[model samples]
Target: MGGNFLQSRSAIRHEVGQYIIRNIFASSGLSLYILVDTVFIAAAGGTFGLAALNISLPVFNFFNSLGLLFGIGGSTIYSINKLKDPKKVETLFGKLLLFCILLGCGFAILLNLFPTQILTILGAEGQTMAVALGYFRIIALGAPLFMCNYVCVNFIRNDGNPQLTMIATLSATLVVVFLDWLLIFVFNLHMLGAAIATLFSPLTSLTVLTFHRKNKQRQLKLKFAFPEPKTLLKAASLGIPSFLTEMSTGVSIFVFNWVLLKLSGNYAVAAYGVIANIAIVVLALSNGIALGVQPIASREYGKRNWENVKTAMKLGIQVAFGLACLLYFILVVFKTPIVSVFNHDHSAKLAQIAVNGLPLYFLSVFFASQNLVIMLSLAAIERAKMAFVLSLLRGYFILIAAVLIFAKFFGVNGVWLSVPFTEACVCALGFYFLTSALKNKN
Candidate 1:
């Protein structure tokens, strides 16, 4: 088995690359879904409506982060130990599902308790607050499904069922689009309609994943196990990078919303929302590739197959950078039309701000995409500290500092350029850490 696996580096990379592409399609589908949803909301509710959606997003992301935490964390461990200790796979899988439920419920309850306060903190006001609260309440109720779906999808992919994961994600995206059209356009439910459309995704995804659990050839099994403290910590630690990566997005939005609120007005926030929606697609492309490379690298690292690990990491990084460059070109070419999609009224100021901001915002993709792949590779190889540091650098430390300094000096332009600056710096650090580690091994 070891010799066959070692000899198949070319085949492995090809196979893994294909697998990663499928995930890209799924993630891209979801990204398009968000963009479509934004269009619908903007058309129906206009600036205030769009801003409301933006306000609620950080809350959604916070809950989603918790799901990713357990899901990615547990899934990584299961991938590493699947062959060595298969029984532990079942235990970890079961425990993670349980944990997702409990934590998701806790979060939902908290959202319910503090709806007004949360909205206020998210920078919602008056009309935006009213619209945002409606979206928030309904979406919060879906927390359990949301969290569990994350666990199911990640585990299914790592269990050699990437196809199923892709199917589920694509199917859910289609459903969301259909529901958004029907509810928002036809029923005229507006913000509530949009929220309902999104709320159904977790259910759709979980239903598809259930088939994998019942499959006879399934590698991940559901088995009851009392959660051990040590095991739970291990899972959280492994998944922290993913958690931070996600939460950082929410944090960025929060910071951007606050800064934009002060610099211009709610219209600026709405315009930023359009740019952020586009960002969803760009980041999703990178995330899909990173997730795709993770299982392959982890399994090889588990076997001490250093050469295969290097090949996989190199291929993944190359794909990441290639996709980033292509995306930036497309964004530049279509900047006006893309901004118009969300601006609806074609407000010149909104269009100009977004068009000006997009190029600068997009430069981050070059570094950010490679950073995600590298960070995930480090996590897969059990370099959790390194991965965590990368997450902090991009997600928190570097990003926050850059945003503060830039936004202070350059206003909104500073806001746009800060992302790329932070990412470029982190990419440099990632290079040093990755190279030094590889040299030490040699």
Candidate 2:
């Protein structure tokens, strides 16, 4: 499979590119379901319910970061090494699967031990605390399923059966939505129903992905193997950028929640929640494009095919920019309608805050997404150091500085502008490193 993609001509390359993108696009159905989930929560539980869910997002992201760290990191290495040694591919997959389960369990234990403390830290209080804790406890129990499902899906995709991956994702989306309606609307379980719906959805993904084992072209194996410290470290180093890229969301959201709570109380947080959910769709599109090209680029580089590497990166950037423009226009033109969808009770103040913030906030996706693609490109080629720097700068350091400085000066509007400013800075640095890394190849 590696040789086939690596050796394919323009026609096949285009097909491969489209195939990868379609699979990734389908995989993002989780975000779509999240959008619907938010709508349901807002309709049933109101602004405070929405706020509670948003507050709990950081914890969910923390566990998700752990999954990406192992899933992507190990898959990157697996893509490159599988062309040279098949046996080692199985070993690496085994190690990543094991690590994912351990990390998930560790997170579950932490949640069980510190549920109240974590809820307080997330800015929950009284009614919101009750709602958020209900959701968190149920989600915590599914940590292992979430983490392992993420790892398996990534492995399945890179194993040469992206169709199966796409099918798995779609299955999960259907199951989640159906259950959400049944449990939340029919049964009136409210937050508990929402959490249960989200939790069980991943099991469908895990179940569907198991079909990949029957594929003759599939190479990812789950044969049990003793873990090696060095291999674990290697995968972690490659995957750290993904972890930080994801974890950055949690960290920034945590900061934003605190700042918004300080500035305008629960209503403000609720407004931001609406915007954040919209941002997820945009981010997922960009991620699909970037991740779509990763295996291709990584494989070509492993075989020392520089021209193919350049082609993949160029295609990814073009698609990201195109998608970004489309998303921005949609947000600007339909700002009011979009806000109203999640605003539920039609609070004028909440609508005003979110509507005013959406334009500037959505613009950030343009540069921020391109930067993410470049960061992933660097990581794919084994330029881990440059990738790490880019992730750290955008995901944490620059993000923190931009949000604080902008909020202090621009007030609420500044808070909205911080994301683009941070991305612009990182996008510039991303190009610099991309140029340097590509130049070194010459």
Specify the highest-TM-score model's number.
Answer: 1
* Residue-level lDDT for 323 in candidate 2: 78
lDDT of 1 at 300: 85
Q: Mind giving the per-residue lDDT tens digits that candidate 1 earns over 1-442? A: 8878656987878877987898798667656667777999999888888889888888777777888888888889999999998866768888888877888888888898899998998899999998889889988888888889888888888998888888888888889999999999899898899889997787887888788966667778787667788888999998999899988988999999999999988878988998888887789889999898899988988898887788888988999988988999999999888888788776777788888999989999999999988888888888888889999999899999898899999999999999999999999999888776666653
Candidate 2 lDDT tens digits, 1-442: 7766566657436954775576556647746677778888998889988999899888877877887788888889899989787766767887778877887888888898889899998899888898898888888888888888878877777777777877887888889989989999999999889999998777898898888879987777787677688887888899888888888888888898988888888988999999987776677778777778888888888889887888788788887888788889999999999999998888888898999999988779889779878988999999989999988998888888888888899888999999998899999989999888887994
Clashing pairs in 1: none
The global Cα lDDT (0 to 1) of model 1 is: 0.86
Name the top lDDT candidate: 1
Each candidate's TM vs. the true structure? 0.96, 0.96
Candidate 2 backbone collisions, by pair: none
